[model samples]
Target chain A: MKLIENWFSERYSDNLQLSFRVSDQLLSVKTDFQRIDVFETYDFGKLLSIDGTVQLTEKDEFVYHDMITRMPFYYADKIPEKALIIGGGDGGAAGELLKLGLKSIINVEIDGQVVEVCRKHFPKLTASFNDPKVKLIVDDGIKYARNTKEKFDIIIVDSTDPVGPAEDLFNEEFYSNVSRILNDGGVVVTQSGSPFYQPRGIELANKGMRKSFPHVASYVAFIPTYPSGFWSFTMAKKSQIKLRTENVEKGEYFNLEIAKSSFALPEFAKKLTL
Target chain B: MKLIENWFSERYSDNLQLSFRVSDQLLSVKTDFQRIDVFETYDFGKLLSIDGTVQLTEKDEFVYHDMITRMPFYYADKIPEKALIIGGGDGGAAGELLKLGLKSIINVEIDGQVVEVCRKHFPKLTASFNDPKVKLIVDDGIKYARNTKEKFDIIIVDSTDPVGPAEDLFNEEFYSNVSRILNDGGVVVTQSGSPFYQPRGIELANKGMRKSFPHVASYVAFIPTYPSGFWSFTMAKKSQIKLRTENVEKGEYFNLEIAKSSFALPEFAKKLTL
Candidate 1:
C-alpha cells in the first residue's frame, strides 16, 4: 500500500496546469470524460482509458486492434495454435489474439492494477479475457520470456511505448529471448515505434529484429489520435511467413490490399533497411 | 472584395471556437513563422509562410508536392510540356514539376497574400518559384481555369479539402472544362480526401476523374502530418503514363520504389474506385 501512497501525492501537466491528478497514479486529466477519480499506472504511462481523457475512439479502437492483431496472424501464414501476450495488462491485445483461433494463450502483465482496471471499465477491449483459452500471468514480460521453456507459435509484445516497464521490450536481450522462445515457423510481432518522430526508434527496433530473426520487415497503419499520426511498423520473419489469406475474411477497416500497402514502406523506410 | 469579406466573417472551427482570421479574404492563423490560412470561400486551405511556422522541409515537402506534380506530369507523358498549378501557393508543386523538365508552368494562385507570406516566411517552399520556368498567376483558380484557353499537358489541383471555394473544383463542369483544355493524353492529378473517413467523397471524386479522363486509377501515400494520419491521393490516366524511373534521385525520401508504392491503394480505398 505504501507503493501506492508514495506515488499518489503529485501530478504533472503541460504549462496549462489543467488540474492533472497522480494518485497511486492512475493519472487522469479532468477533461470531457471523467471530471474526477483517477486510477493506477503501468510502466510506460497512465492507462487513461478506464477513467477519462482518452476513450476507446470508434476509429482508434478498430484501427489499432485490427492492425496489431491481424498483421502478424496473417503474415505467419498459420492460425496461431499457441500464443503469448507480453505486457498487455489491459487485456486488449489478448482479446484480439483470442479471436484468431488460437488454442491457448498466456498474458504476462507486470501491473495488477492495469489488469483490474481494464477488466472493469474497458469491457469491449478486454472482453476476450473471459474466454477459457486465456491465462493471465501478473509478471514481468522480460523475466517471463527468459524463464519460460514453452515455445510459442506466436508471440505478441503488445506493451506500451519504450519508456517504463516496457523499456526492456525495446532492448536486444528481450527480442532475442522472443526469438529463442518461438518455434521455427513461429513469428513475433512487436510495435516498433511511430514511423514519423521516432524514426530512430524504429531503426533501432528494425536493427534489433534483424539481429534476432532471419527476415524482418516493418508494417504501418494510420492512427489519428497517436502522436506523429502513425503506428509502429510490425516486424516479422520473412521465410515461409507469407501472410496467408485464403478465405479473405472481411473486417471493417482491414483486408489484403491494406495489408500489402501497410508493409510497403517508403523509400526512406527502405533506406533504413540497414 | 465581397468574397474577401465573406471569407473573413464566416471562418470558424469544426468543434472548438478557434478564431480563424481572414486577411484579404483568406483565412490566416498566425503562428511563430508563417500563417496557417484557409481560403474557405474557395473551398481549399493554404498554409502561408507569413511568420514562424514556415519551414524548408525538402524531404517532407516533396512527399506531397512531387506526387501531386510529377506523378501526373508522367501520367500525361505524351507532350505535357506546359502545365498549370492551381492553389499550391507554396510553390512546392511548381518546384517539383520543374524537375520534370516541363517547358513552361503558370502557378495560378488566387491569394497574393499567401505568395507574399511564403516569400517572406517560407523561403524554401516559395523560393523555387523564382525559376523562370514558372509564371505566377495571382487570381482565383476557378476563374483562371475557366478563362484559360490554351490546353496544358497537365493540371495539378493542389488545393486543400473540398469545402472551400475549391468546392466547385469537385463539380462536373470543372472536369469537362479540364478535359476540354487538356491536350490529348493530358492528365490531371487532384488531391483527395482520406478514403478512410470519406469513402463517399473519394468515390465522387473518382467518378469525376473518370468523367474527365478515359483512364483513372486511385493512388495513395503516407503523409504523417495530415489529418486522419495519412494524406495525398492521386487520380491519373495510365494510358500515357510511364512511371519506370531510371534516376536514383539523390534524395532522402522519393525514389522509384516509393513511386510505385504510392500508387498502390488499400482495400478500404479499392471500394471507392469508379
Candidate 2:
C-alpha cells in the first residue's frame, strides 16, 4: 500500500457511482467495478492503483475539485470575501476556494502528513499554497470551528467521511460550531453521503444541519465512483438566503439552473428530513 | 474474490470515494471513514470495487424502465392498444408498459439469459413476468421488428450498451422498420447512453430516431447505476403529437418540472446533437 499515493485524477459524478482511474496505470474503478490488485506506488497526496483499483488521478480529482467548489460558488450570493475549509488536507478544496478570488481563506486540516503529501505530490493542486490569500493550518476542523473568533462568508466542509479522525466532524457539536463561526448570511455546504444505499447517514447529517441553521436542504448529483451513484450534499444557510446562484457562471460542471435544481429533493429523500 | 462474493451488500455513492459493505456485514459502509477494506466485495452483479474506494453495482433498470414505457404512452395521445418492447429481457420496461394498461404487449428479447437472470436475481424487478397482458417473445428484436405484421401504438428499445449485439439497435434501418410498424400517432423511446460518458452515443441515437419520426426530443435523468448517473433517452413521435411529460405527477422520481428540465442539455451535449 506504500507504492502509490499522489497521482492526480479527476472524478465525474453521475447519479450512480464515483469512478477514479490512474492515468499511469490506466486502472479505473467504478461503482461495483474495479481493476483488481492495486498496490500503493508512492506517497504523494493521492491514492494510486498498484495491484487493484485505488488510483486517484488528475481526472478523478477534476470532478471533485470542480463539483464541491464550483457548485457552491454558483449559488453564493456574492463573491466570497472570507472562506474556511475544514479537512481537505490535500489542498484541493483550498485550491478551489482560492479560485473564487476571496479576500482571505483558511484551510484547517487534521493530518499534517496529508498536507505534506499534497505539497509534494499534487503541486498543481496545491499551487494555492504560496498564494497570499490562503493559510494552511494543521488542526482538526471541529476544534478550529469551535474556537474560531472570526466569521467567514462561506464555510466548505471538505472533510473525509465521518470515520477515524473525521467522525467528530459528523457529530452535532461540530455542526453547532460550524454555525457559530459563520458570518451573517453565510452559507455552508458539505457532501452528505449516499441517498440510494445508506440514506440514514444523509438523513442524520441533514438533521444535524437543520438544527444548526434555519434553512437546510439536501440536493444530489451522480458520482459514479461512489457505491450507488446517487450522492447527496447538504447545505445550511444562516439566513433564508435564496440560493445565491447568479451569473458568475464560468464553471464547466455547474451552472445557475443546476445550482437551483440541485437543491430540489426527491420524496424518498424528503422523507429523511421528516 | 470468491470469498467476498458470498456477502450480500449494498453500496452508497456520496461525493467522497464510494462506500460498500455486507448487507448485515454488521457495519454498513459509512462516509465516516473508520472502516478498513470498506469496499472489498464483488457480487456478480456488483461488478467491481477497489479497497472500498470505488464501488459499482448491478446496472439499474428502473430509470430506463420508467422512461421508455411512459414517454411514448404519454406522447402518443392515444391509448396504447398494442405495444412492443424490444430487448427488455429484464421485464422492467415491460412492467412499465403494463402500468399503462395496454390491451396486449409483446416483449421481443433475443437473450433468454437476460430474462432468466433478471427473474432470478431481480424477481420483484421482473414482476411483470406473471402479467397476462405481456407476451414474452424469445427472439431477436430486430428480426421480430422486421417481420411483425401487427401495427403497434408504442415500441420501446431497451437494449444494452451498443458495444455488442446491441450495436444495430441504434441504426437507421431498425428505426425505419419501427416507423413502418407503428400506427398513426404511435411513438418510440429508446435508452440512449449516458450523455456524460458517451455523449456521442446519445447524439447518434437521437439522430437515428429523428430520421424515423417527425418529432424527436431527448430527455435525460440521473440514474446512479449507469456510467455517469446521467442517462438520456430519445423520444420520437411519428406525427405532430402533443408531447412533453404527460399530466402524470410522480411522488418521488419524475414530474413535469423535471421532465422539462431534463431536456435542457449541457452545452457540450447540445453541441453533440448539432
Candidate 3:
C-alpha cells in the first residue's frame, strides 16, 4: 500500500511556486468572471483562491483586512461617514469599516457567485453582509463607478489582480469617474500587487492615479500568503497625505507608527512608483 | 518520449514549502558541518542553500547584506573600524564591510567547503576574500567567540538558523563571551529568522542579548527567497542606539528613512520581542 499526499500549489510564474499540504478542498466553483476555490489546509487553515491565485487564508486575513481599511481611515482629514467598496465580495473590507463608526457602507462586487461561496464557506469574513448599515450590490464595478450619483467620503478598490475582470479598475478613466463621485476631503485606496514580483502593478496604478489626484503614494504590507509575501497599496486624495487620527485601535497590523513608516519604500520599490 | 522537469524546493515544514525551477545543478557537496548546494535558477538567478534552506540568491542578496551591515554601521556611535563576522563563509558580509573603510575583518566559519563552493560559483560575493584587509578562519564560531582575545567595534553573526551546529550561538553564555571581546560602545547584530513562522527565533535572541547588553532592539527586512519573505535582525550595544552617521550610501536597500522605519513593528510582531 502507498500513501498519496495531497497538496495545492500557486504558480506565480513558470519558475516560482508556493505549495501547501491540504486535508481536503471544501469548495470549487466557476463563476461568471473567474474560478473560486476554498481549501482546508494543515498549516494555513481555510484558504481562498480566485483564478488560481491565493487571495486569503484564515490565518493571515487579518493582516490584509487591517491594512486595506485602517491605513486610509487614519490618514483621512476627518472621520469618514460613508464608504463605497468595489470588488470586495468576501465582506472583509466592509467588516473592518463597520468598526470605524461609518453611517453607511455600499459594497459593489461584480461576481455574485463569489459572495454566495464566501457566505457558505467563510462565515467570519461574510458576517458583515448581514449588518443593518451594510448594502451589498451585485453589479459590474466599472459601470457602477461610472454611473453612481451617490457621493461617498471614502472609496476602497478591493479588486483582484489587474487582469481579467479587474483590469479596467487600474486605469485613468475609471479613476476619473471615481474622483467625481467622492465628497470633499475624500480618499481612495487600492491594493497594488507585489512590488517584488509584479512591479508593473504599482507602476500602472501610480501612473493612472497621478492623473486624477494631487496626492498619490504607495505603501507596503507583509502578507505571507501572497505571491512574494510582500504586498503594496496605493492611496490618493485631493489634499496632502497626513495622519488625522491616533485613535485607530481596531487592527492587528496597523498602528500610528506603522501608518507613517509604511510609506517609506526601499529604493528598488521607489523606482516602480516613479 | 517523456520530458522531465527539474526543480529545487526548501521544505520550511511538513505542510509548507517554496519551490524554484532549476536549469542546472552547479554544485552539490556534503561538508563536515552541513550540505551546500548551488543552482542556476530561472527566476532568481544563482541560488545558494545550506542544509536545504535558502541562504541567498544573486538577485536578492543585496537586501539581506545591506540590512545586516548598513543598519548597524549607520546606527553606531562612530564609524565602525574593526569588524568580526561569524559564519559568513560566502564573504558577502565581508565584501559589504570593506566598502565602509574598515581597517580589518576576521570571518570565522565552521564549514570550509561552503567558502570553496562559493568562491567558484558566486564570484561577485566572494571577491572580498582576496582583499588584504580580510582574514578567513575555518573554525567553530562558538569556540572562537568564547576564546578570542581580539577586541572589535562591530560583530556580525551571519550564521544559519539557531539550530544544528549554530544552536549555541543564540544563548546567554555565547553573548556574554561576545560582550567580552567588543570594544567600548561596540555593536553586535545577528539574523533572527522569520517572525511570522518562527517567532521563537527573535524571542530567544532578544532574551540572550538583554542579559549581556544595555540596549537591544530588532528590525526586519524583506527577503523574498526566504521562508516567509520577512526576515529580522537583532542589534545590541552598551550605549543608546542613536544615529551617529547619515552617510551610509553603499546599499540599494538602506536609506535614512528605512533606517528609522524598519524599527517600527506591527502589533503582533511587537509582542514577540517583549
Cα lDDT of all candidates, in order?
Answer: 0.63, 0.63, 0.90
| lDDT by residue (tens digit), candidate 3, A24-63 | 9999989779999999999999999999999889999999
- Highest-TM-score candidate: 3
Instruction: Please give me the total number of clashing residue pairs in predicted model 2.
Output: 71
Expressed as tens digits, the lDDT of each residue in B1-274 for candidate 3 is 5666889999978999999999889998987788999999999999999999999999999999999988878877888899999999999999999988888999998999989999999988899889999999999998998898899899999989888998788999999999999777788999999999989889999999999999999998889999889998999998898876556573687787788889888888888999
> Could you give the C-alpha RMSD of every candidate to the true structure, in order shown?
8.7, 9.1, 1.4
**Candidate ranking (DockQ, best to worst):** 3, 1, 2
Q: How many clashing pairs in candidate 1?
A: 22
Candidate 2 residues lying further than 4 Å off, grouped into runs, are: A1-56, A241-248, A264-267, B1-60, B71-82, B112-130, B143-153, B179-187, B196-200, B213-217, B221-230, B238-261, B264-274
The estimated TM-scores of all candidates read: 0.79, 0.75, 0.98
Docking class of 1: acceptable
The runs of at least 3 residues in candidate 3 whose Cα sits more than 4 Å from the true structure, single-residue gaps closed, are B1-3
Evaluated against the true structure, the overall lDDT of model 2 is: 0.63
Which CAPRI category fits model 3? medium
lDDT of 1 by residue, A1-274 (tens): 2543222211111100011123354334343312333444322133344322332333355667677777777777566688888876667778777766788889887767666666665667677778899999887889999999998888888766665456678778888888889877777888766666566667777777777888887777766445444676556563655868776564545776776667666666666656
Chain B TM-scores of the candidates: 0.75, 0.78, 0.97
Relative to the unseen true structure, what is the C-alpha lDDT of residue A209 in candidate 2, on a scale of 0 to 100?
83
Q: Candidate 2 lDDT, tens digit per residue, B182-251?
A: 8878888788887766776788787787787788877767665455556778877767756545456453
